[model samples]
Target: MSEQQKTVALEAELDALRREVQRLRARNAELEADRGFPGRLVDALPSLVYVLDLEERRYVYWNRELAELAGGNIGAAAGPLRGDGLSSMFHPDDIGRIEGYRARVAASESGEQATVEYRARGRDGGFRWFLERGVALGRDPEGSGRRMLGSAHDITAHKHTEQMLERSESLLHAFLEYTPSMMVAVDVEGRLLLVNREIESYYGMSREELLGKVVYDLLPPAASASIRKANDEIAAAGQPGASEHVLVYPDGPRNYLSTKFPIRDAEGKLYAVGTVSVDISRTKQAEAERAEMQRRLIEMQQATIQELITPLLPLARGVVAMPIVGTVDPARAEQILTTLLEGIAARKARIAILDITGVKGVDAHVAQSLVGAARAAGLLGTRVVLTGIKPQIAQTLTMAGADLSGIVTKGTLESGIAYALRARRRS
Candidate 1:
């Protein structure tokens, strides 16, 4: 209970504490020795493992891979890796991103991990993409970053693959958007899945407005019906089919040659119908115009032929000679009748000489046509004089029951003209 006894007890307790501390240190060393070789183990890994003193902005510990990635020995003698040190190691465009990640990791709580991907300069002086993940170890007394541990894995191949995929998607999008035909895809339920720029432009609507809508919703009932029929046929046959229809736009109607085909996946299961329509309105209009022109041309040709066959020549003051050449069918006979009646009314002719010098033979119909013409002209007060009937034609007409008794017959066109003039003089 005295001061000496208390002092002795305090010394004993202090000595015991020191011995316990020494034993703990020895145990830690033994544990470290029992583990695998740290240097060889770290150097064998492909990824760059490192520890950093964030307060001093220096790499406290780094593996051989880290040194190789940095293109230098990475230790205390290598100098601190701050903004400038890191900027030199990263791509110029990626420096800002690296700095942003550094700031984030420095502010993170202990055991909080942060990941960043950036292009880093390699030993070969070429930049390669790397994915780095860091955990905040602890903070300093002032609440600043004290230490951090991280690993960096080369992701150059992954980044390159990503870029290639992006380019392929962009190219496919461009091809679908700018193709000239109106391309569209509809699901089995008739819902639109895809639409091209041509379809958007032709319908004056955006793809957003067209997609997910039923084809019937975008088109008139008539047009939608036709399209539905074509789609059904394609779906049933699992093949392509052609359809032509008029697409009535807000401006006007346009003809389109639509080709519909079944869309199948690699598994050969029919999933949708793909349609490609080309505007054929101009072609259709051209064909219609050509047909109209052909009809008009035929009318002109017939008019020319009729005029050549029937020619009325006036000889005397009151006499007119109509010379008919070539065989006259019923149509030509009707034309002759019309010409003779018109000429008689215009000229007020007292005698009309009908010349048929070019006639080979007159059948029953031809003889009737002549009789009908003469009777019609008599009713109009124009006497008929038939000319240019050969003897064999006259005999043929008589044998075929010809009834031209009431018509005056002449041998030649000249004789007919002379007779008409003589009759006019007497009058």
Candidate 2:
């Protein structure tokens, strides 16, 4: 235990330590040589590969893909983010999301991977999307995963595609929900695929309740059968057709003009049917009203003509004039007789003038009707005078053997009226 003995022993131990250090360095060199091809392969990958220390919140290794993604060089994001470095290389909005993604990776068990989509800012000052898939690389003393190995693939194109699809679906839904006419589309199975607002309102149901429902089940048997026939015809002919059918409800029945057509896919195969209907019940009602009004108008016109043809006018007190115009058929001759008698009784006229000044021809029936009116007035103590005795009319009455014995005859209506006035004054 002397000083000299202790120095000798210390020197021997130092020598042994030096030999052990050299052996360790040689072993390290051998391990590095063995990793040559694998390291190169990892560097050659297209994916941005990295190893992260979950507990340290920093990166342990990064491949060359990081440099390529950051635009030919790492630049600000060359390695793990330094103080405030993350804000410069990654989108500010996505920075907050990284913590949540990291937490999920840290909590996952071995062999289980977690995926996150985030945006990163490149050298061009534009943001690009990346999908990171991370798995637990190691665990801590408490068995919690603290290290993560992950790869990120650029997913900007895929994200754009998904966004476009969502936009298209939204536009289609809007068109189907707001149109004015009743419209519906059904698959071959008769399941409702689309319905517009008008259809929903007409059926007294909401879109949520109507879609996927069977059209046949919602309608009456008569309506459903008619619609089925139309649909079948359209499908078989592969053409569009129009039809009219009545759909009834508690309120009433509605007449609809519907256009039903087959819907074909790109392969020209029939897969669905669409119907657009317009309610025409009001049109039908208006037509019926118009027809009824026309009938009434015609009847009124005929009554007015009858009144004009057979008129009995009072010339003065105790004197009435019957001016007959146009051809007198048997029906009209009777009307004249009835009117003359009624006029004499109603006005208490003592004289009646039968003026045929405008008559074209007097047949036996007409001559007889005139004599009958004169005799009928005589019974009421009213004298009758006949005027407008044209030469042809006198000859015809004589040839028919008609009797005008008691009836006074005048050549013109003016002479008849003047004579009656004079007779009245004398009486």
Candidate 3:
């Protein structure tokens, strides 16, 4: 073993070591390049990417997207990434939610996935909705080495749309609940779908309890048949119709006028029936009142005609006695005068008694009718006798300037009749 031999062996060994180092360095360079690609790709992505240190509950690696989102570098952000509780980017309102999600994620096993929606501050200094999805990368039994990989998406527009839909639905519900009119919507089969507060209160049931019940089930048997007929008509016609009907409620009988129509879908196929009911008890009562008034008017007209025509028949004996009752308006005055003149001419009577004992008073029109009747009787070769003048009647007749100089007078119908009979005998 010589010095030359030792030196040669050492140089060979050193060469072998150097080759191994070169191979290892090449593998290291490949691995570094592979890692750099994903990092660079993540930084260039539009959405934020993060690697979270679960044990510390902070971001371990953050991309440029997150840096820009947070309005600062990832390490400097005020949230969990900066080790300052959680990101100040999170809305104060969403802090509890983020913490809860983090706890849930922590409790899950490695590779477990979770998602959460939270509010994050945007670069524009406004809060925007964000959806974060996280997968557990690893977990430490000691609770210090847990980690997660996550990505976040800006869901501001989607959240805003959801909020708008919620508001619109809320408004529709409120409108149905608060409107004063009794409104109801039913399926084509007459199953109740929706009813307003008024209907619920009127029917003495909650809306939830009443839904899906048949309309007929809530009504009395007598009313159910009629309401079913109306609903069927509306469905068949696909048009609105209104009618009044009597309903027997738990409270008692009531009159209701209902307007009903079909509700159509987008394709114009009838889907449901909608109805608005107005309580018409008052209106029905008013109609009854009008009918009574009309009946009274007809009765009065008939009675007046009878009274005027009956007395005229006896005028043929050369004398007639007529009794007037009730206050006389122009209409009655015309009837009386026309009857007396015609009677005098037909009967060829020499004397006729116009009795007013039953009369309360005479207006100017009545006085004129009486005067005209007397003059007409004179032309017919008849003498007119005015009788039964109360103090008020005399005053009214005098004030009206009626000429009664050619007429005889009596105080009552009996007296007028007696005078007429005596005059008839004398004739």
Q: Using alpha carbons, what is the TM-score of model 1?
A: 0.68
Candidate 2 on 1-427: residue-level lDDT in tens? 9999999999999999999999999999999988887778888988888788878767767777775665533444545643233455677788778778878888987898899889986546788888999999889998878789989988889989989999998887776676666789888777898898888887899988999998888887888889888888888898999999998868899888999999999999998999988888899789889999999999899767766887788888899898988787788888888888887899999999999999887788777777787888899999999999888889878888878888899999999999899988888
Question: Which parts of model 3 are misplaced by more than 4 Å?
Answer: 1-47, 75-86, 143-145, 161-180, 197-208, 236-241, 250-252, 264-269, 290-350, 353-427
* lDDT of every model, 2 decimals: 0.84, 0.84, 0.81
> What lDDT tens digits, residue by residue, belong to model 1 across residues 1-427?
9999999999999999999999999999988876847877888999988887776777767787877766543543455555245457778888778667777888988777899998887878888999999887888788767788888999999999999999998986897787887889999989989888988887788989988988777788999898888899999999898989888878799999999999999999999999988999989999999999999999999887777779888887778888877777787888999999998999998899998888755677877787789889988888899998888778767777767765788899888888878877888
Kindly provide the TM-score of model 2 when superposed on the true structure, using C-alpha atoms: 0.57
> How many pairs of residues in model 2 come into backbone collision?
0
lDDT of 3 by residue, 217-326 (tens): 88878888998999999999888999777876676778989999899999989989999888888788899999999999999999776675435647446777667787
Q: What are the TM-scores, per candidate, against the unseen true structure?
A: 0.68, 0.57, 0.57
Relative to the unseen true structure, what is the Cα RMSD of model 3? 12.7
Worst lDDT run of 10 residues, candidate 2, spans: 78-87
